[model samples]
Target: AGITGTILILGHTDPLFLRELLEYRITQTVIDKAHGIQLDAAAAQAGQIPEVHLKIDSGMHRLGIDTRQPEDAAAMFALENLNITGIYTHLAATDSIAGEDIAYTRRQIDAFNGLLRTLQGMNIQIPLTHMQNSYGLLNYPDVCCDSVRIGASLYGMGSKEPHKSNVIIDLRPVLSLRARIVMIRTLEKGECFGYGMMFRADRKSRIAILPLGYVEGLPRKLACGRGTALVHGRRVPFAGLVCMDQLALDVTDVPDAKPGDTVTLIGRDGEEEIGIVDVAEAAETLHVEILCRIGQRVATVVIDE
Candidate 1:
């Protein structure tokens, strides 16, 4: 961390004591700022230190000091007590499934490069240049700088396999989403179920209700009025509009359904598996967006079998 006086800190840790860990960068600039901090001064007074890094917006435009204004860069250097270590940007559509946004991705990279040129004229040296996110690492290798940061793949998720010479490691999914059936109704020839009366009985049907629904992140787009679920090793189309806390599926074929029957919302039953990607394709969206929006109310069960 000290070789460059920059430590990428995530979450909520104070930067005051960080100076001590910057073993390689003990320059006076860092020492002075470390001591100047009002960080419970009396306690840290004995160990005042200051090696720091500031985030400059290259193109992400999400967080960091927007360098669009030269003053933003100037304001950062003006902080006499700190050292600017690195600058980075996040590409917006590098992971596009269509791969049609290559131009946009390259444009952002060019913008960041422009910022670097602008800073160099002002005598600012940005030691680390990183832009590649998981998507960037996979589809836009040109954006990888300093190091590559990976996330979705760490837990075995929707990352595209990169064609890089370095073998990409495959991670295992650490979670499984499961649910239980609350009730099973015998649908008479004219019965209807769920919100908006979306599912009408097509011939005496057996309907099973699961205590999970749109509230749990099931795509409401299923309102095309057709959806399905995994039931007893078979696929059952949803009978109607997915509700807030429950959904109904036609389980007539799965004659064994009962109040206590366990259902697989996103797993395999026998030789059938319902992955989120399949669900996303059906809903016409990327699996990443759908996974990110999964409601917090659902229990995240970690199982190994």
Candidate 2:
């Protein structure tokens, strides 16, 4: 369990590809959890094991076993055949010095540590501890012990403030979204565009259509949210509503608009670049979700280092 914990806790998010449809990867997280359970069971049967940790959810309410619920935590600890390890919790801002929210996390940490103390009172020999995240790692070294889980930091998203880490790190964004202009059409004044007839041409317009649509996960819910596109090295705006298998952009301003010109939807476009994070901001999501939800059939060309 210690070795397994080492593998995961120390593992950085840049390498842990989060494509949920990757069944093998999904199987691995589950298998590792099950393996922990089995290892505990074996140790309990032998009665020679020292300890293990139960990740407790004190407040943030995402992952972790419920330490506040003694029954739940105890049941998790009392796996058919294993010894209990230390208990750990996650603080929302164990790193940030924000406000009253910090107090809740403090209470959570105290509660989790208290839970460990209670288990010790029951004579459990659990060892190791944690209440930290990447931000916590930067701000609070106290949480660093036998192990600490660091995500996003390794990718150079190291801090919540500006001027955080100018030191270069070897991390890369593994996602890219793109589509090519498949056709071109000229729209006269008063002509409508796309479904719902929401957008009408105020003047004659030349629109370039790309072969990507809302069905490809190109966020249809984003109304007038504006998608970034490149035409002849100059970025142009999507003119009207995005539809399935196609999206229209006003390419009238483009110097040489034509069909079959490769356009960058979300990637480098000259010195003025576009990133998935930029797209996510327009689509109302984080870079994490944007990276995770790259559409199927879209080429994920991994340019190896």
Candidate 1 wrong stretches, greater than 4 Å: 1-71, 80-86, 97-100, 117-129, 147-149, 159-174
Worst 10 residues of 2 by lDDT: 21-30
Model 1: residue 82 alpha-carbon error in angstroms: 6.7
Quick one: best lDDT, which candidate?
A: 1
Expressed as tens digits, the lDDT of each residue in 1-305 for candidate 2 is 13322223311121123332122212111112444455554445544442345666677676665566555555555565433434566777554555565576667766777777777777666666766766556655654445566765654443534333223344444445667778888889999887787667788888888887776777764434367677667878876787776788888788588888888877666766676656777888765566555578677666776
Clashes of each: 4, 6
The runs of at least 3 residues in candidate 2 whose Cα sits more than 4 Å from the true structure, single-residue gaps closed, are 1-53, 62-64, 70-72, 81-88, 93-97, 125-141, 145-174, 221-225
Go through the candidates in order and give each one's C-alpha lDDT.
0.63, 0.60
Q: After superposition on all CA atoms, what RMSD does each candidate show versus the true structure?
A: 7.5, 7.3
Please give, for residues 144-169, the per-residue lDDT of candidate 1 as tens digits.
47866676655466553443213354
TM-score of each: 0.70, 0.68
